[model samples]
Target: MAGLAALGAFAQAAPMVTSLGPVRAAVFPRLTGLGRPGHVALTFDDGPDPASTPRFLDALDEAGVRATFFLLGRMVQRAPALARRISDAGHEVALHGWGHRAHIALTPAQTLRDLRQGRDEVASATGRAPYWYRPPYGVATAATFSACRKLGLRPVLWSAWGRDWTATATPESVFHTVARDLRGGGTILLHDSDCTSKPESWRSTLGALPLLLEHCAEQGWKAGPLREHGIADADAEIGS
Candidate 1:
């Protein structure tokens, strides 16, 4: 009976993972990280890498921009000081779980445990509790939402992605990929680390940063971290 109940819960959540495309974005804007008009949210995932993250940080600093970095706990543990540097440099630090595993692959108990452990690890390294969560591969389950509620974390996914994880991705390709779907009030996803991607893929992402910011500036849009993207009010209304 206990096994059956867990299976039922998993069954109910499995479809959401596969169905979170344009329709889901249109129906659940807040969950897709949509926010205020004339503003764009900048975010990265699977990072705090010692070699590459610093370069991304330097690029953002030079551009006078900040972004939210969704960090993996194992990565944070390996580079705690770099994690501290991320917060100290004024970017937002958010949880990306203990490992880069999809919630759909974990049972409800496993999902909660991963989130809690990652949240604590991030808080310990950054000295600030993370307010947002982005699951690996942008896949969320019913367990993901429930665990976020229990841990006081809000789930957010990107509206536009650079597809910068590929070996074939170039700076121009990254920019154009994001530009194809990016609009004001959209969230842009890129990677600052290549831990889960092709080696040195972050270089393409780093190169595309200037182009993305320049494009946003040309459109009279303010691009910054999620905190400044105005998600709180939208989330409040949607979650209610």
Candidate 2:
């Protein structure tokens, strides 16, 4: 019975994984509208900080684009106002764990506890439970998926990452990595907060924002939240 249930769930979720290959999967609600042939979604994690988040929001405002923000529960508790600001600015706020810890290393119960607390904290600040949950560092396991299922959240991953967690990564490098790897249904990972030891990681992404937006525009692509797209099996006949 357990195996059958698992198979059913997998079938349901499998369609959410885009065939574009290895790009991160974004759970619904945090996801924006579906992109055309070459469109992509931009997502930022570990945010709601006073230092970098405001500037990031400012840049998004200037570019006239809305992106997904996977926020840490602890950060939301510390900066509820900033969390509110993100929502008010029309960006989707999703969960990125309670403390931004690794899920793969945690027991299933521990993972569930963290996810529950994280969802509650984010909902308290933003007035809605985030529909998406991104594991810190893209770490996932069976326990992680189970916890997500229990909480009614979906797992999202990225197709292209800027490696902005590193201090040595230049803004140009960030741009190059994203622009070169972008494809339809791709989710790009970045960070709004500098939790890393290096301040350059945050600065590099902030610096690259305008250029990245311009590149998207030049490619005739627009940026938005991840929830706008729906997942359905292309091979499954509707009336069959």
Candidate 3:
């Protein structure tokens, strides 16, 4: 029965992971932002690594940019100080999950528990309850939405990602990948931690940061954290 229930849960979640539309709308509250022209938002995931996170922070500080960080609960527990630093540095700290498991892999109860636990862990570290949540791998289901509403958090997804977790990714490739899809009011995804990602995957993202920012500058786009995106909960939703 347990296995059957898991399979049934996966069935409901599968559609949302691959395609956006009715399933996307039916499952979660709307995702706002990612529209307009020249107002790109930069977001990072799976982070707060002591070694890499601070480096990213330094880079963002030097660049005069602020970003949103979707942090894993376990990682936050492992590096609370680093998590605090992220919030202290004026970045948004959102919930990723307690573990890096995809929503489909968890039962509805488990998913909610993971979201709450992750939210609590981050809040403990940051002294602020996060108002945003992004599921692991950007996969969501009816349960994810339920959890979001119950926890009083909003859901967000990206419009473009660098694919920087691939071992062969380079700065040029990362920059080009994101640049091609980047538009006005786009949400750009990148990683700051190698914890759940491919080892050393953070390097390419780090290397591409300045270049990506430069491209945004040339295009006259302003990049900042998601809090400034000015999106409503009635907007379109994104799939994994």
Best by lDDT: 1
C-alpha TM-scores of all predictions: 0.91, 0.82, 0.87
lDDT of 2 by residue, 166-227 (tens): 85788898888777777665677889998743664789999888888888788776667766
The lDDT of each candidate is 0.86, 0.73, 0.80
lDDT of 3 by residue, 1-240 (tens): 332234236547563442442343234323523545657889999988996999999999999999999999999999999999999999999889899887777889999999999999999999989988888877766677778878988877777789898988998999998888677777888999988778998999999999999998988988988888766543233221
Q: Rank the candidates by lDDT, best first.
A: 1, 3, 2
Which regions of candidate 1 deviate over 4 angstroms? 1-20, 232-240
Between prediction 1 and prediction 3, the one with superior TM-score is 1
Worst 10 residues of 1 by lDDT: 1-10
Candidate 1 per-residue lDDT over residues 1-240, each given as its tens digit: 332234235436664442355755675678788888899999999999998999999999999999999999999999999999999999999999999887778999999999999999999999999998988987776677778878989888889999999989999999999999898999999999999999999999999999999999999999999999987544342341
Clashing pairs in 1: none
Ranking by TM-score: 1, 3, 2
Using lDDT as the yardstick, the better of models 1 and 2 is 1
Q: Candidate 2 regions off by >4 Å?
A: 1-38, 229-240
